[model samples]
Target: MLRSSVHDHTVSTVPTREPRYEKKGLKAHRQLAEVQALQEAGQLDEALKKARSFVAKNKKEPAGWRNLGRVLIDTRQWAEAKRALDRANALAPDNPSTLINLSLASYHLDQFEAARSFGQQATAIEPENPLALNNLGMALIKLDDFDNAALVLRRALSVRPDLAPALSNYGAALNRLGQFSEALDVLMAALKLNKSDPYTFVNIGNSLRFLGRDSNAIDMYNQALALDPGMKEGSVNICNVYNKNNLFDASFTISSELIEREPKYVKAHSVMADSLIGLGRIDDAKAAAESVIAIEPASITAQALLVSLAARADDYDAADYLRAARRFSDLHDIYRPDVLANPADDAAKLRIGFIGGDFRRHPVGYFLKQLFTEYDRERFAFFIYHNAVEYDDLSDFFVENSAAFRNINNKLDRKVAQEIADDRLHILIDLAGYTKYTRLSALVHKPAPVQMTWLGYYASTGVSEVDYILADPYVVPDDCEAEFSEAVLRFPDSYLCFSEPDCDVPVRPAPVSENGMVTFGSFNNLNKVTDNVLALWARVLKATPGSRLMLKTMLLNRQDHRERITQRFAAEGIDLDRLILEGPSPREALLDAYNKVDIALDPFPYGGGTTSAEALWMGVPVLTKRGDRFLARMGGSIVSNVGLGDWVAEDDDDYVAKAAAFATDAAGLIDLKRGLRQRVLASPLFDGRNFARKFETLMTSAWDAYRARNDGEGR
Candidate 1:
């Protein structure tokens, strides 16, 4: 979950005392006291009337204006409060009381910089004022200055250890900084002091969510909502958690209700889009995302969603995806920093940094395991900048193998980029493009002289700072070069190298022989199986009689998703009896499940990557239709690398024809199945050592080019 909104504490007011005014200002002091009393009594209208009368009589006195601002704040009139506060500040420059009120008013007006300035002035004047420090910290938090916010909040806490508001804000800063455990501790302390503080509960929920305790996080959010039923952040956060966990129905329900209540809620619309994407409702997802864009034109999340959706749309090709990606890039234009200097030495050990948020049992992690384990560390120093809170054994492997491993989950994009720039990496590779928790924003800072995007994401990042994209000749053909924003650096054979599965599950014989029928399956995410892919699969099932298509993915765990898939397939003239839909399973079970299939049907426009490799590893030949873009061509790359290019089809007709013909040849099918695993294992696709050598060579080549360019420019 992203950082939850911080609810500022009630504005602190100073005692109204006229030390400067003598006997002549006695009446003014009395009037100020009366206004303060009325404001304290919550009679804001009466207080405002009295304050206006006092201000009108003593137009030059800062006390009257300050009292007026305080009453305006009590009435939630932020703009007028700011005006009055500004008047008071102009009258009594550097007055701690007036400055504090100005800070609060500015913060409410969304003038965070002004708020910070006022807070700084107040803190400078009264060094140990808890209210000044607390307000300063809150403003810093709004500005994504968590490091400074944490420091200021720490000072506030030191001044008054039981300052619950300071404690809550400090916990929020800790959460953003990626110190979930410490954040939880601080927030829990705050909760003890003020159980009814809804924002504290939300902050605690964020910490729990970051710690991978989704259920506990949900409970915390519920606690927050229970305290304040009108807390939109708490409701939106719960929807976010539900979406993350693939509870699309729940997320959709909550987001829908939120939209009904408040149609302009951008976060709710964004989560609704996420839920729609998970449910394979791409068109609806696009609409939801468009709604977000309409509401917030510069929404990075919505633009990124459109990029992914366009890539998956059959009607939308690479050009459309690029357009969407570039729009997403536009949102980060403000974040772009000056390019860091190139490394001076040409022959030194090239320090290569890999930045992403998926070094924990994800497909990206699996793909990188072999490379990390087998790469020539002597020639290239590896640096891992992990940007996620969750880490498992795979993460440990990365840490153990890398020269330096930093968990940058808590740092802001600019700080992460600065850290990377400070590291002076020769080449930095972005493993995530626009995926969740992506650190792609760091790449915009141009932290390294040579930056490229490789695995994890299929399409071009459209980030101008990204110099190249790792590809193979098959996945990125010459004709498609124009589609990518980055220069394509093609490998000789396959761009990816699969790690041999650790499990020793023996490949079973073709299921067609035992069952007297062909069992075609696809274990990739349902979202990848677009409407066109489904219709094509339906045709394949129709062409091959007595065939069953087994579709298993995480989304199938939801009954609504299963029904949706069944309905879509039924509309394509496929019967329910011939379809087999199953939910996710353990890795071992998933691999073993492939034994029941004779052939695997790969989805198009966004074909399987790890799933395709896994299918081949399980002796199931993946029948893939070639596509125009990298996302659609991955299956062809994998299958061709395995010397089974015949399984790759040119179009829908060819796909159905291949499936039908392959099923008819029962003997050939069994023999192919028996030898498929060995074929893949012996091919370049599984050659980790070979892939590492080529990878290192490419890195060296790219670095050499970078140096040559810089030298030509006299850098």
Candidate 2:
């Protein structure tokens, strides 16, 4: 085998040693070419290794270390790059390129101070270098030296107009400084230069969202997601669009989906709670709100939702809700002082702030419509803080006369507080007590120093912060003073003084149906129709065998709910066919439905307010049984005030007797109906100016008392 392998020639290989100068020259040329080739190919890792090898072999070559640092930057080995670049600078102390590389590496590692020093050195060496200027600007931005960042970025852009990164970074600086419109233009230009930049699009959206172009912001989010679907921020932003538009169900669906992926996401749960509340799923809303509180104990959303839930349930455990509310109030605090001198001060000219959600066609509005119309603008300034979304004709009058009217519909409590403080209000009244959309948090924040909860809510807020709750002798009996958060302030005849609008309908002289079955009507919310109320109503129907009970409410608008109500009445030994369940009707139709009812049956525990008034206006007397609480006596109060004391029953037994007697006394009933409208029209209950004057007197008294209590404190 050895003889056959003669061609292998293992005997003849001699190691060649060349002259030192020639070998060194050849090696130097080869190393330089390798470094240049790797750098040109953008193989920074391989290039760094090659350059480092060359530096090790030839320690005197500054170019080798400089190239190595540049390669380190490409690999983002910023610290190592800084060291190598520093070595190159030391070896050749005046090289602008070496100084620039050192600055770049420092900037990449977020060492803005060191980066700025090296950048200054580079610019000092070659003051007009566009790359160096751009690098300096970016470092300034990273350091949050936004003013300086703007100056340097503009300089760089002036030197090199096509620099996309510098333009985009400059736009962000403008955005940080609140020049959103200009920033939008610059960011848009950056996008035009480089269309696929996700950050630029996100920044553009951020500016748009800030400007309240929420739909445009949503479109921008969609565009960003289209470019990169994994943008979680964009997804959250899209959900916010649903929130802003009041498409709460859509928002909830998106939030629920997000929760599946991130179960403890606090913002998602918060949005879910809001959406659920909008959908009227209060129990589910409570659960979602609890989840938010569990995740973030100090979250404002959680605290506010819990407050709302307690208010809605009519169970104010005040401790937590009150404390949080006080904290918020302290932050947004405002106080009122008499601006005019004592002699010049006109009690008639004090500023009045009205806070509520129902300036629309609601119970609170019905009572105040005439008062606001006759508020005597020459004597007082008025401000309204409306919390609800819906509005009607009466709302326009409030808007027109009020010195300032703020629709604080979607604003947070803090923002609302700030606005109130800005207004420098004198007297603040809470027209909405515990009703839905009543921002108790804003009241807690103490936007105004003198605050009173009045009118709309019957029960005490159970928060000691309130100064008073407006009532009358009938609604606030002297014995029940302990039930109030504020001192009980009573009007002369009634707490609710109706302001009669020109909506007059002529009284129908004849009976609704002498031939038709004797019909009883109740127009109230389903929530007010408690079990006991239903039982009493059932007794009224049973007492008159042929009489039909017309149970009417908004809830009955839904077929399923209507069926449920019918079934419930049937279970109470009422003939289902005889129970005429009617849905919500328009105002005119509601009045028309009155003619169909021979008598009105009021709800127990929570009697009808506006409905009772409406029935009286239509000349239909209501029979109401007095209960212990204010809510239970609204009907009795209205009936008594309208000069129909006989119609105001004293108890369950009296209610049955009164209703049957009214049914049997057709001639007396006819006389009562024919003359009842005139009686109400003349009564103090419908006198708007009289009520407003009384209300003003009460407010002046409250202010006087408030000032007297704190006179020595120099408030």
Candidate 3:
């Protein structure tokens, strides 16, 4: 087994040979011909030996240096090849052949810009040259300029229609640009010219994978590996397809093998991180993300992953993650403010925009119905910019409710930002704040006059372009504003406004009386049930005699999560029989599970938002231990808003006491359950009519504040 990597900084600074450039004599040319003959006979090492001897003997001939460079390239000695080519170019500075080989060596060395420069110089010297054009296009593709790469490669094919390399590279460029059908056509053309090209097969697999043809993509990747067993590109694509199919174990196997083969392979480490997360190994996922950051300091995605994992537990405060979020500010440090089309405009029409990833069957979508449907249509022209692929009935409702809807899933962040600016939105609201598949980078351009973040995240997003965070007095207090990057825009009662769930299930009487033993439960995400939260829940169960805890989550289906939960409880002296772990079920069945419990428990520091509301709506009162941060206090706000502030505990002792008291008072529990839904319906949490008015006022105020700031009339 071997683990190693090749990086751009590992190349030697000193030249491996003497620097000389001149076509010396006919003797040098004849020696070069002999070296070429050995290379053409499939003897790269022999050719390298002969070329080195020729260059050492004829030290002044540029032709000898060029021949040595060609042999070095064939031998896969990129650094030495670059040095030889550098010496050749120093002597014969105008030779297209020297420049072309220099570009090839640079490409192998991962010096993409240098390769493009050398290839461009060669093309300038010899117009309509297929070799130079194809090399330049491939270099641009490596640099992620896919649109121009496709154009350049197409021009190269026009000069030499049957050039297989150009066709293959063109297909890769189109595939990257999301033109999968066109890429397949170009790749098939390339395959007809060269049937054994492994990379062309990998590119075709990539196109198929992006087109959602996972089974076909896997077959193509296997074909690529069959042609070249050592091709990492094909293996990496296979791992990606496995992940797409939710086969995390298979993804882990292939990615781990790639990592063992090359420890510093960045893509392999990233894929491994995703696999780790899917398997519910938070600690391992964090470590994998850290490894990526150690390899490349500019990896914002890895940093985001680490922060999100830390936030799931009580490992750090909001201020800590808030500062970490500022790392993404460097992504567009050179961006200057563009003159707006509606600069210092009047308030005849206030256009508001909401951009998010989860406009589907998620908590954000559940809460967005009122805000989108109940807006004052004449006062505000609402727009939606969806950044995700998930679309369902609620998503269609959002589209129907809004004045305009645009799907920006395939657009680049900067391009989406520019389009938002073109739409002349007065206030752009971000519903996806660092959540999965969010386009947080788009807000860096500050497309609207005012930008606010809401719903998707619980704490400060730390993006400087976000002017405000829509919160409530209970969630974010006046003193906590210093910790946030954005201004804390407050609502009087609660920041949340949710509609009812789809279940017709009604609250039942206390289950404690029927079962003769209290059953406490938590329906929050398994990841939020951190070690600290689990330890606290153990104490609650211990305080209540004969009480059992019911934990249900999607991860409970995995044996690992179930085993881990059992081990944690064992440390607390709690029996495995007292714990009921259930996997995911249908929506109606999940809501019905609350009937089996007397009370629900909320995890600390990252408490439930929708889970708490749903539990209250289902006649199960949740006891949450309040903390200092917004995420920790979300349960408190919801309970306080629902007229049951006593259910939210002030500390750990209070939490355990509340759970015991609620479980023992069977009569009071029955009474609370019977009237729980009506209580919530009467509270501000589900009062969509009042929430809509307040939201409209908030947007109107934000617009006025923006106009005042721009007009030099400070608010």
Candidate 4:
């Protein structure tokens, strides 16, 4: 989810000065004073009239023009205020007060660069002006220069320690810098000075959300709404929190009302799309994303949603998915740094850097933990750039095992790329392609000589600067090379190396023997369970008499989500009595739940990665259909690598046949379950040491290729 910045159009106080023209400007100065009095008294219409009359009478007077600009700013007429402020600036070129007002006007008009320039000019004139520093800090936040904004806001507070606006903006900068706890302290201080400021409450909410205190964040947002009921930022923030927590029903309710109240609110549409996606309404989600694109053509959120939706659809098309990814890269192609020279010393340990946001207890973290522990430090030095807000014990493992670990969360893309380039890394690998909190834009800067994407994503990144994508023969075959923008670097065995689960849950016998009925289960994400997957499962259930299918995922915790799943199965002619729907559980419990299943069913087009590996570890044999693309073939790779090639089928009919054939032989199922774990442990899927050796060789070969190319170009 994207975070929002706070912007307020509170006009700065104009400085009092004597009239330049002793006799001719006396009337103009008196009229401007009366206008200021009316504005201070909240009679904006009368104040605007008096200010315009003053400016009309003494058009050449800078004080008259400045008074008119202040009145326009108070009335929230940003464009006219900018024009009046520009006139005042032309008359009195170095007036700090006029420049400050111009900065506020430009910020309100969405001219961030112009706002920054005006603020810079004001601060250049008066270095210790609190108002100038405050406005400049706000403009810097708008431009994603969080570090510099923090310094400027601190200087503002140093000049006037009790300045509420400066404190609020400083808290905002701290939140963007990933210092959430410090931001809370700064925001609370701002609240004590001015309890009625809605923007301060919103900033506090942002800090709470980033700190993983969702309920507290919601309460803060409610406080903001209570103070100003029509505040769009607070409402959108509440919707975002609900979506992140998988409370799609609540999110849908709020976002739908927001859209009705304001038709062209782009953030409302984006959150509405996320709600629809969580609710498993794919078509509605696509339409909502399209609505966002129509309203704001260059919205990166909308383009990324289209790409994810295409990859997860029932009728998955490789060409359409690639096009969507390409469109995202095109829109995100804002930074392109000059290529740096390759490393001069060939014998130095290759500096390999991995950049991603999933350094916590995520699938990417699990897979990477084993590789980090097994990497040969003699030939390589690992640098970790973590871009996530949350961290756990697994995150600590990454930091302890790496030579250098840098926390780059919430930093600007160009800044991150520059830091990576400064590290002098020989190779930089991206673990996140287009997922949330991705730094793919940083990769566009070509910070390293060899850049590759692996593991976290399942398809082409569509970034031309990315040199390659790590895959295996089963997932990305020879014929599908044209589908990717990068070269396909195929691994000899499996593309993924499974990290054994931390907990130990003893494998139990097949549930078929105890219940006298087979239970086929799938614990993949509900978003991957398209109508096609459901229909195929329905066919398998029909083929085997008295067989049941179990569906488990985090989304099933919601009553609406459970009902949606039940309704979809009923539409496929599957009875409710034969279905087992479950929600999330603890790690050990989740692993133990597989004890009740005889066969694990994998979803199509986007098959399971970590989920499939877990099912095998629990001794449940997975039956997956072979597919034509990388995402669709993940299950095939896992199943084939673990010496269970017979469990993989060629097509839908073959899949049903295999499921029926496997379930009909009760004794055979029992025998397979008893030895499945040991079988997987002995196969290449569980051979982490060998996998690391192959990985090292592959990376060294890629570096050699990069050096060859650079030598040919005489770089």
Best by lDDT: 4
What is the per-residue lDDT of model 3 for residues 1-715, given as tens digits with 9 covering 90 to 100? 0011111011111112223434456776667777787887888888888899998887767878888898888788999989988998897796888887888889878799999999899889976877778888878777766667888888889999998888888888877665778989988898898888778788888777777788988898889889988777777778777765556778889989988998887778878887777665678878888888888777656766765666554566666776677765555555536433332255456788899878878999888887776778777788889876557898899888887888776466667788898888888899877666556678877888788999888767777788999999888878888878899888889899888887798677778868888899998777667677888899988998799999987778778768988998999888999899998778788888999888889987878887888888898888887778877878888999998888889888888888888888888888888888898988889888899899888877776777676784322
Best of the two (1, 3) by TM-score = 1
Q: What lDDT score belongs to each candidate, Candidate 1 first?
A: 0.84, 0.69, 0.78, 0.85
- In model 2, what is the error at residue 227, expressed in angstroms? 13
Model 3, stretches more than 4 Å misplaced?
A: 1-27, 33-41, 57-71, 88-104, 116-137, 153-175, 178-195, 204-257, 276-284, 309-313, 330-332, 336-348, 388-413, 502-514, 712-715
Please give, for residues 393-432, the per-residue lDDT of candidate 2 as tens digits: 8788778878887877645556677787677666678886
User: What is the number of backbone collisions in each predicted candidate, taken in the order shown?
Assistant: 2, 1, 1, 0
> What is candidate 2's local distance difference test score?
0.69
After superposition, the stretches of candidate 2 with alpha carbons farther than 4 Å from their true spots are 1-348, 501-504, 509-513, 649-654, 712-715
Candidate 4 lDDT over residue span 279-355, tens digit each: 77888989998998999898766776777677767777888889888888887565654565344255368788999
Lowest summed-lDDT stretch of 10 residues in model 4?
A: 2-11
Could you give me the TM-score of model 2 versus the true structure?
A: 0.60
Candidate 1 per-residue lDDT over residues 1-715, each given as its tens digit: 1221332222222322333432336777788888877877878789899999988888888778888887888787989988998898788787787788788888877689998999999899888998889889988888878899999999999999898888999998888777889989998998898887788888888888978899999998899889889777788889878878889789889989989999988778888888887777889988998998899797666777777777667786667688888888888877765566444354357899999888879889888888998998778889899987778988888889998999887577778887887887888999988766667777888888889999988889988889999999888998889888999998999999988888889999899989899999999988878777888888888898899999999989878788989999989988899988899999999999999889999988888889999999999999998888888889899999999989999988888899999989999989999888888988889988999999999998998798687674311
lDDT leaderboard ranking: 4, 1, 3, 2
Which stretch of 10 consecutive residues in model 1 shows the poorest summed lDDT? 1-10
Candidate with more favorable, higher lDDT: 1 or 3: 1
Ranking by TM-score: 4, 1, 3, 2
Best by TM-score: 4
Whole-model alpha-carbon lDDT for candidate 1: 0.84
Query: Candidate 4, clashing residue pairs?
Result: none
RMSD of each: 2.8, 15.9, 5.4, 2.5
